[model samples]
Target chain A: MKGIRSVLYMHWRSVGSWVYIPWLILGSVFLINYGWRSFHQDSQSTNDVGNMVIFIYLFTVAWIFNGQLFAFASGLSIKRMHFVLGSVMAAILISIGSSLLLMLLIVVENMTNGWGIDWHTFSWKVTQTFAYWEQFAIYLLVFLCLILLGFFLSSIVIRFRKRGLLVFGVLLYVFFLVISNTSVNGFDHEEAFWTWIGQHGLLVFYSLIPAIILLLFGCYMLFMRRAIIRS
Target chain B: MHVKLSKVRKAYGKNVVLNDINMVLEKEKIYGLVGRNGAGKTTLLKIIAAQLFPSEGTVQVNEENPFENEAILSQLCFVKESQTYPDHFTVKDILLTAKATFPLWDETFCQALVARYNVPVKLRMRKLSRGMRSVVGVIIGLASRAPLTIFDEPYLGMDAVARQYFYDQLLADYADHPRTIILSTHLIDEVSELLEHVIVVKEGRILMQEDVETLRAGAVTVTGEKGKVAAFIQQQHVLSSQTLGNVTNVMIFGTISRQERLQAEAEGLSFSAVSLQKVMVHLTDQEKGSA
Candidate 1:
């Protein structure tokens, strides 16, 4: 029971304390944007804020990834697997909670503005068509997926502390940004992989599911790793 | 609080650190684990603490395997020279965490030790000097009050005065709590007075395990002319020998009777009791030369 208590306490110290830093940063950015938009009477400015917030969210992921991961590594003693599981699970829960709360705020803002959410748009349809609990559940799932991605990256960093992961972090950011911003081809060909990924019925689910499963598996492997054996 | 290590072996790639070492540690006594640097003292302690798993054989504590076994480890406290903690935690925070983690942790004892050592509780662990950090470690080890407490070179950065204080406090506390305590230190003479049992380790093998009093009782030193000393040592197990001009002093294990003492004295010989420190050094040196 004391061991469990120690694990939970360590998790709270690492993930709980760090959860506030990114939440505050993202919360403040949203507050400032809401104040600016209200002052300027410009409805279009809100979309720009939403887009900018994505990069901020990514940075928050990097921050949470770094701090939570090092704490996880520090907590590793005799039972490396148990420590790693506690850490990765704590990180996942915190990241999901943070993302869900922020998404709820965004949806509230949209509803208060009397805007009609369009079903044809992927983001707007999910926000509008689903019932309150269903919408919340969907957002929670998406949040869990992203948090898993963050945890996966953190585990990779631990595995490669000898190699500079800072470079890898920057490259990952750029890769995600490019994938989100453009089609897979330069000439805008209809045969582009990104076009197919965006339109296909099964490809989207397939790609997303594997990423989630791989991340969870990576977290599992982190627990089983024996760094002391190497030492 | 007994540890039974059976055929324990640890290796790294091509090099072996501990080799088929079998040892038994009983309850309610102080044991001094003596060995040269890299002679597997720390490795042996770690194995007993369950911080490491042996490559072969078994280390059993309380009739169960130690690795991943919280029941045994919860009762054990191990203090190392380079113990690590997070950079964010101050010395007070680490102690607080330890208090929460260890069921038998004595916070009052820790606080008293903090005051006695004059440690700055508010200071970050990383900012503290090496000596001060060692003091913090000592405080933790003493205050943990675990059933099995193992301290490995605990006073490395401490001065003679502080080291003496540590030994005194350790003996004083141990007198009241009679738990199993194993101290691995290079300062043999300073701790020999407190040790109940001595386990001499050499080249990953246990050279000897005997009560300290018995070890001391069995050693005798004889000084005489070189010829007489040589003749006397040839008939006994000579541990060490020293020569000066025509005089030779030989340290040998086993008792020397009054008749033998009188005979040697008549042949220009001097006899005296050998201390534990002298015996340990001689034994270790003898081992090294043979190796």
Candidate 2:
């Protein structure tokens, strides 16, 4: 248990200062609001640019993980298994923790009446369309998936180093190529696939969470076992 | 703690780094891991540190496999020359983290070293000079108080003063807290006196492993007439030889008897004790060419 706690603490510290992530999320909100408030003639117009800012934050956090993984494994006095378990725990913390913080900011925004300028960064229509608890559940799901996506990408990037990035790019390009070619050449098959996806969209998206998590975890385990510090 | 490696083989894509190596390290002794560059010194250390997985056999620290073994790993600290810390972390941050994680951490000693080394606590690690960064590693290693600590060429960047300070501090601290310390270095002569044992590796194979004094006493270089030196060196393992005019200097390995020495002296041969560094180089040098 001490080893696990130590590994978890190391992972959190590797994420850098405690304030970095929160500041990244909140600072972006305030800066964008400052800019938006300055430019807007009509203050009533609502913008949900927080989603875009938060997505960038997710990407940056994932890159930090990739940068720190090698040293993170050997730095603290912990086994790779402990690190793996602790990382999964940290991932959940980041996901749920960031989600809750964003939700709280939205509550604060409501209290302050959107910083006195009706900036709807956190209180956007997509989230507000749902009931209170439903809204909480929705962000929880979204943030979890977003963080998982970040972790998956980071795991691949760190596990294989530069080769992983090249492969990722190639795979994405091939995927796009396949989609464009099939859609243009055979619209009927594409249309049928879309109809099926529409019928089971929620189920497909939800199932992908575990599939992505499992795939990343598998790759992480296989590579990190033999991983050497790339000094 | 005891560490044993049995038939360990590490290779990468047909390039063998370590080959069929077997070794056992006993508790509470300082060891010098001596080898030339590209001699697989770091690789062997990494294996013992469990930062690397062996390709063939088993490595056990304290009678248990160290690979992902928390019980064993918690008792070890492996410091490297090129360790990287997170960008925003100060030296204080690193020390604090180390203190928190390592159960046997000595905060007072750590802070004392910090002051002695003059490393600023508030400055970010990235901003520190390479030498300063190395001092930080030295501080962490000394203050961690792990039973088995390995420092692999981490003093490469330190100046003479800092290096001497580290050696002195290391010796003083080791005297206070008796634990196993392995200094893997090419600078053999500098640490020869401090080491209880020496392990010499050449091209991924153990050339020799023995106590420092025994290893040094195992060889003697005799200088005299070429014929007398040749006669005396006969039936003895000749490590190296050089012929300067009539004088023939021959480094003979293994011990020589009192009668043999008297006979050699009577035959006009004078003996000189070989430095451990010279012995290491002579023993490992493939072109130990006889002149």
Candidate 3:
């Protein structure tokens, strides 16, 4: 447990600056949206996808931190299991923090009527009917899922280098291509799949718990167990 | 701590880096791991440090497997020549992390070393010069005070004075706090005196492991008239021999008794001490010739 704490502390010390970049970007986007909405006097609620920026940034943070910190932790004689556990715990803490912040922002947005410009940045039009706690849970689960996916992908790259990323990219492209081709009655199958997810809402987010576990497991067993620092 | 490797072999794909490596490293001794580049010195050290796994066989640290064992890892520190730090990490950050990671970290000694080396604690690691980076590694290795500390060419771009100071500091600290230290370096002569035992590695295998005194006592260079030198070392294992005009110098590998030396000197064959560096060169050269 002490080893895990050390790893956690090291990670925070080294990459703590990265934690704020997403917020900075989100804040900038919010300002721009607010300015545009105020200037245009748009009363209709806008379904801005700007909030998705945080998720993308979180993914990037996870990918970079996993790749770099794994080598650094190994240099410190940290056990692989401890490093993995520390990373997971860090991700959980970040997710919880982000979820709470998003929840507060959503409450503020609702109370102020979308910052008085009818722009939905925190509370999307699709999920405004859900309770605040449920939204927080969804955000937490989504953050964890994306972060773990990033970790799993980064582990693949660390273990096999560029070739692994190339292979994974090709596989992902093929998967999307197959999904796009499997259309039914003129409706795009990929869009239909997302529509199903949108309809399920909380159920879809809740299902990510198993996926997060699987990604964490794959990261450890497939790449991290015998990983070595390669210059 | 006692470290034992039995039949340890490490291979990358079909390219074998280390093979049939079996050795015991006793506690509280400074052992020099001298070998040429690509001679598997780093691989062997990594195996012992638990940063890597051998393809076959076992490595026992204090009679326990060290892989993922926190109890063993906390007592070991391995400093590499090309040690990498996070790009944003300052020297102070690294020192703090090392202090937290190593159980026996000496912050006072670390600060003293930092002051002695004049390291810029606020500078990012990437902003530091090569020598400065090396100094950081040296400070961590020395201040960690680990039971089994291994330095694989920790002084890469350090100046001569700094290197000498590092040697002095290492020796002084070892005297004060006895622990096993393994120094792998190409500058054999510079560290020869600091080493208590020398482990000469050649082509992924240990050629010889002997005490410093025993190695020095066993090898000698006989210099005299060509015919006299040739006659004097007739039964000895000659590592190498050179002739210029009527003079000859032959490096003999086996021991020479006091009576034999006196007799040889009386016969006008003079002897000179062989530097550890020369011995290592000739030894590796001999291995290459045979191979």
Candidate 4:
């Protein structure tokens, strides 16, 4: 119990020292919010603006938060499970809190000036909003996808030392090209992709299984492999 | 609580670092661990500290394996010369972390040593000079005061004044609260007066382990006429013999009896005790030349 607590304290102190980074992330989110409101205010497709805002928010957090979390875990003595749980908890709390405050502000603005943006369409694109279960399913899928992406990034980033960041960019571009060219699932068309996703939600669920397996396997190779212990 | 290493072997890839080493470290004594560079001194200390595992044999501390054993780890403090702490953290933060990690940490001693050394509390570790970094290691070792405290060449960068301060504080602290302190260093002469027992390692093996006074008493240098000194050194382990014309200086490893002393005096021989520094140099040099 004492060892566990000590590990927790150490992890908290280390991450807490990087509080400045999170604040910068939050500031970027606010800037995105203000920019979206102003730029789409006069557009004929103003209704589509909310959808874009949601996409930006989700993508930004997924990219920045996951990257910083991986770096934090690499440099600490804490266990991987503890780090994963702590980061998830902290991200959920901060994202939800910020979203709620922003939601309230949006509501007040709509009530006063009658702004009309399609919440259903925005939510549908960022997160499936057909049913609670379907929404949760889509969220899980996105999480697995991003985590696998993060795992791959972390593996290469940490393994290559100084030139890791540059190498990762090139590798990601190559990976993107490979997936685009292969089209192994015969869903090169958007209609086919969505139709397949809609008909066989189970298939979507099954796709996540492999992504999760790959993610965990990559994590083990990067962080827990005995050979990673440097003399 | 006693520690023992029996037939412990450690190898780095194709090169052997520690070969058939054996030693017993009793509790409540100040042990001086001495050896030259690449003599497996740090490797041996790391093995005992549980920072590195031996490739063969066993190292038992208080009848328990020290590696990953929190029960034993809590009682051990291994401070190295280049002990690392986070760069952004201040000295106070490092002290706090140490206090949190070591269950038996002494706050009073920590504060006293910080005050004695006049370390800057607010300064970040990266900004501190080399001597200050050594001071930090010294403070941690003293403040931890774990049942087993091992310091591996921690005073290398410290000046003479700071080194003296550390030695004085260490002795005073140990007198008031006794603990097993193992110090691995090349500065044998400076610390010979403070050590209770001396363990000399040569070529990855235990060359000699004996009480400091016993080791000092066991050797003497006899200088006289070349022929008489050469005859007198017969049947004795001669560490080294140098001849300049008729005068010869011979260092023999073994005590001179009263009769032997009388006989040497009658032959107009001058005798003196061998300094610990000279003995260590000769011992290491001989091992190297033999290899």
Best-performing candidate as measured by DockQ: 3
Cα lDDT of model 2 by residue, A1-231, tens digit: 666676566656655443366557668767866786767747365656565566556646655664564474476556766666666677667667666776787787778777667766775575565556655655666665565566666666666777987898899899999988978886867778888988876577667756766776676666555556656
For model 3, the docking class works out as medium
For each candidate, give its TM-score against the true structure. 0.78, 0.89, 0.94, 0.75
Residue A190's lDDT in candidate 1:
44
Judged by DockQ relative to the true structure, which candidate is superior, 3 or 4? 3
Per residue, candidate 3 scores C-alpha lDDT tens digits across A158-220 of 888889889989998998887666664346466767788888866865776767667675655
User: TM-score winner among the candidates?
Assistant: 3
What are the candidates' individual DockQ scores?
0.21, 0.52, 0.66, 0.17
| List of clashing residue pairs for candidate 1 | A81-A223
* Model 4 pairs in collision: none
Lowest lDDT sum, 10 consecutive residues, model 1 chain B, at: B282-291
Query: lDDT per residue, candidate 4, A39-80, as tens digits?
Result: 666534322333334334444443444334343222222233
Ranking by lDDT: 3, 2, 1, 4
lDDT of 4 by residue, B163-265 (tens): 9888988899899889899999889988887799999998899998989998898778999999889888887777887888999998878767899889889
Residue A90 in model 4: lDDT: 45
Candidates 3 and 4 compared by TM-score, better number: 3
Model 1 per-residue lDDT tens digits across residues B121-229: 9888889988888898788788878888889888878889888988998899888877899999888889989999999887787888999998988888888889888
